[model samples]
Target: MNYTPWDLVLDAGFLSALLIVGILLRARFKMVQAMMLPASIIAGGLGLALGPHALNVIPFSDQFGSYAGIINGVVFASLPFAGSFSFRGKLHGARKMWAYSVSTYVLQWGLGLLFAIIILGQFFDLPDGFGLLLAAGFVGGFGTAAAVGSSMEAAGWADASTLGFTSATIGVLVGVVGGLALARWGVKKGHAKLATSLAEIPQDMRTGLVPVVSKREPIGHGTTSEGTVDPLTLHIGIVAVVTAAGYGVGLGIEALWGVKVPLFATAFLTGMAMRLLLDLTPARKYVDGTTVKSISGTATDLLVAVGIASIVPSIVMSYALPLALLLAFGVVYCVLIFRFLTPRIFKDGWLERGLFTWGWATGAVATGLALLKVVDPKSKSGTIEEFGIAYVGFSPVEILMAIVAPFAIIAGLSGQFIVATIVLGIGLIFVALMGGGRADAGNRANSFSNVAP
Candidate 1:
């Protein structure tokens, strides 16, 4: 069906209603509050149940599956504008973070491919690309999965989108529930310094309602010299402009080279360039970081709901066995990473860092922050600060892994596996070098601060 502007409005309205319902459910239910599940995930589940594939209560458009990728482009394009990046005095932390993150990516990809080649492909009638759904879902979350799946679909991978969405949905559920379990375990083991009961958590957090004090705090301000357009309007206007430019850039590359590329990569690069330009000029004063984050957050919530709602039940059922196995393996791998790998990488605050990494690896960064709050409510571990520094280097690796890795698999699955295995080997070496001797060191003196890159 040809979607008109009104169709877009209807789709937005339906999604908004589901989100509200999800917030209400989460606020009213103690179990959901304990899980710390995002309102978006809950909303997505409701949408899936009531959507065309299920009860058919909502009149969703036939082209609904495509919305995830399109909205993902918007989210990515707005990211670089939402935060500032600097390398001054953070080079060491950035390198360590990049190594750790890239290693995880390589490990996840290698495991997925090995399993696919050895078992799934051998036993089932699934294609080689089936292996990639694991990392695409678990590491990259819904946005990366949708973007990569759409690209793969253009390259003749049937049902890739459905598989990707299904993987993402499962990853998110596991991330929330499993991460909570891990945090609780850490508290019991004396790894978490500050463990509080559910009653200790702020009422606003337990329920999705903002406290009066939080509402009163000012997040952003108007520019000193306002032009014809409003300051907030200008910020959003810049995001729209860059988003379109990024899409155009992706199209230009495809038209010129005839290669299918993920639009989010170019969008990200575009946003970075725009950020750099704004920083270099006086225009940076008018652009508020908080407003940019709000825009990105809004796009992400809608994308998650639409992505989950678009899952094809028949496709999920057909691959049920493989899906279950993949998810199970993912849980084990994450646990091992938290239990074994985390202590080795960071000298101090290993539990806090591990919990946060597990949360992000499985779901998204916000999930990691939520897990971190559970362990160290006061942020005494400095996990958040160090992670922010490390992300400057880590984000690019994420984009490359998400955008290029799948295409590499498509080009030559064997070649991709070989390269991934080699990368994984190198990553393991780094992990061993970073974690081995420090395992016995109980003092923070032997931490990453003392280690050389």
Candidate 2:
């Protein structure tokens, strides 16, 4: 059957309804409240249950995966406009944070590939590109996995996309559940600055709803004229245009080099260029950061829900044992990074930084923010603000890892492993230089002083 635009609208409407149902269920259930699970995850579970693989209730359109990919592009394209990217004045902390982010990326890739080459390669008939799934799932989350996995599928890795999505799904669950466990552990060990009892959290927060008093104010100062475009519409239009431009740029690159680049990476760069252009123009005044953030948030929620719902059960089941091993190793690796490396590097708010890293490394930036809120509700730890600044320097490395690394693996799997190991070695040396020796003592003292409540 040829699906029309109305089919898209209908599918979106159904998902929106599922999202509402998930929210209501969360609000009414104690188990979900304790888990602090996002409505998106619940909605995704509902979708998976109702989808074709599980039941015959909901129509699983062939275009569902494409919807996720397109929305992922929008999410990345909206990012640069969502906040200011600053690189001035705070040099030391920013450099340390950047190093930390890159080190994690390199380590995850290196370790993942080593496991695949030495262990999985010996017993399993898997492709060389299988190692990339670790960083793709953990560091890049579902969006990058879906985007890059699609590219890999085109490059002749038949099950790459399904494996990527499966890894992402597991990463999200680990990020939420394991992160909460780590948060409580931090409190027990006196690492958290402000620990709250379960009963102390607001009902709305526990239930995943905005309290009446805490609801965000409208974006624009006043309503638009009857004939004029609404501020929200205007912001969305800008994102749409930028997203299309990014798609075009990706196509151009593919045409020129005969190698496909992930659209989200290009979209992010295009967003940055657009932001810079806006900063240079007077039109920047009309753009609201909040509105851009809202757009990105919506795109992310939809991407997560659809990405999870679209997972092929047979593919996941086929690679179950290897996938389980990869995820198990990832959990241990993330925990060690937080427990040992984070405190040695961050001079202040080590717990907050560790929690944030665990969140993003396991899931997405939104997960990091969620974990940050759980531990530091008032944003007093300064983790989010500092990480935002550091991301300016870190994002290019992320793009390279997400976009370039997969293609390199496709070109020569052994060569990619060698390169990944060299990068990981360099990352380890950088971490030692920054965190070891005299700096470790000063860092520990600063961390204690900052978190001593």
Candidate 3:
């Protein structure tokens, strides 16, 4: 618990070294690029190999495990600053995407709880809310892994963060490695509408380098004069303010209610209030969405690397057998969910989009997009565009699951939560398959719901 400034500096140096190495591998190796492996994953992987959990060479600070939860606060805090969530018009395609995504998301959580209570809990000595790790890592990624792990620790599960990160790491591997093989099968089956073969991918993409011709737009616009305040600094300041407010709110709630809350949720609520206050003044115009988003990405990258590097190997090994079984169920179940639900949800680009969703279900959205790039190289399927619109609506549901599930487990309401999630997922599926009409209804006979969100 006692440390100096030098401890912080060394940890930063080690993490930065691992990140740079990951970047270099992605840039220099065609195989790495082909798998669409983000530098964060590569960095996290290497960090684990070199840190105390494995070789004990990096000399990371005792505080390393805590960084992910701290940085993840920024990710959540910046959410509302980016702007309102809307679906534009009822693009029927967006409905299907929302429906498909929510159905799977809820079901995954429900199934995870079921596995924890009915199966794993019966066989192994597990902590409360142990089953929720599947969706926490697989669907939530390292961002949620850190937050969920932190929350569980507060609720008396000390090793939850390590297990969550480990689950997320495995999910990413399955997404990247298994996804490529699935892509090949899609192409061979003639279901991939655009790309014919994996070998046809362009050179720049294969090396993780964009050409000069592709660098057409600036990442962000400057609204403030540099003498007064830098634009990036303004965005970062906003994010920091939200993170701090969330932490204060968290402490206040704990004092009043006697239960710890999820930091990400509190940060998000704080950001929402801040965003509204900014909108009342001219300050809203200066809150650059792009710059704030960039800061989030940067923090997320560090969070992933640290999350993996800080895993406690002895704890992981203690529960290794049951843990492996849970992850194996996660991998196969995600694929099965995609196969069964996709055709019912998407009429066009089913194969390409389904494969993309599978990657997302397993781990990261970037991994899903990578699979999409390979299967629909031309971007002709419009999967990403539809998902963008769909996400506007689906996001709150994701936040709800993240906040509610573990608390339910700790409160001994796992059965009720699991049943609610399963029922919600099934109901959403029906809403996807049947319907009312909202889009083009005046012009035609059917509503958007008649056909799908």
- Runs in model 1 lying further than 4 Å from the true structure: 94-98, 196-200, 214-219, 224-227, 421-425, 428-432, 435-453
Q: Which should have the higher TM-score, number 1 or number 3?
A: 3
Q: Which parts of model 3 have CA positions greater than 4 angstroms off? A: 87-93, 435-453
lDDT of 2 by residue, 1-453 (tens): 898998898789888998898889889999988877778888888888898778858886768767877898998898888775665654344556666777887778778877787888888888777877887898788877877787787788878877897788888889989998898888777787665643445566787766696574664432245479877778889999999999999899999998676678778889889899989998887788888878888898898888788888888899888888878888898999898878776644588888989999988887787787777776666566567666876776676677766777777755656566567757654764455332332233344222211
* TM-scores for all predictions: 0.89, 0.88, 0.93
- Between candidates 1 and 3, the one scoring higher on lDDT is 3
lDDT of 1: 0.77
Instruction: Give candidate 2 misplaced runs (Cα > 4 Å).
Output: 196-198, 214-226, 253-257, 346-349, 413-453
lDDT of 2 at 363: 87
Once model 1 is optimally superposed onto the true structure by TM-score, how far is the C-alpha of residue 192 displaced, in angstroms? Answer: 2.3
lDDT per residue as tens, model 3, 370-449: 78888877666667766776788888888777788877877889889989999999998888776333232122113323
lDDT at position 101, candidate 2: 76
TM-score of 2: 0.88
Better of 2 and 3 by lDDT: 3
Best candidate, TM-score-wise? 3
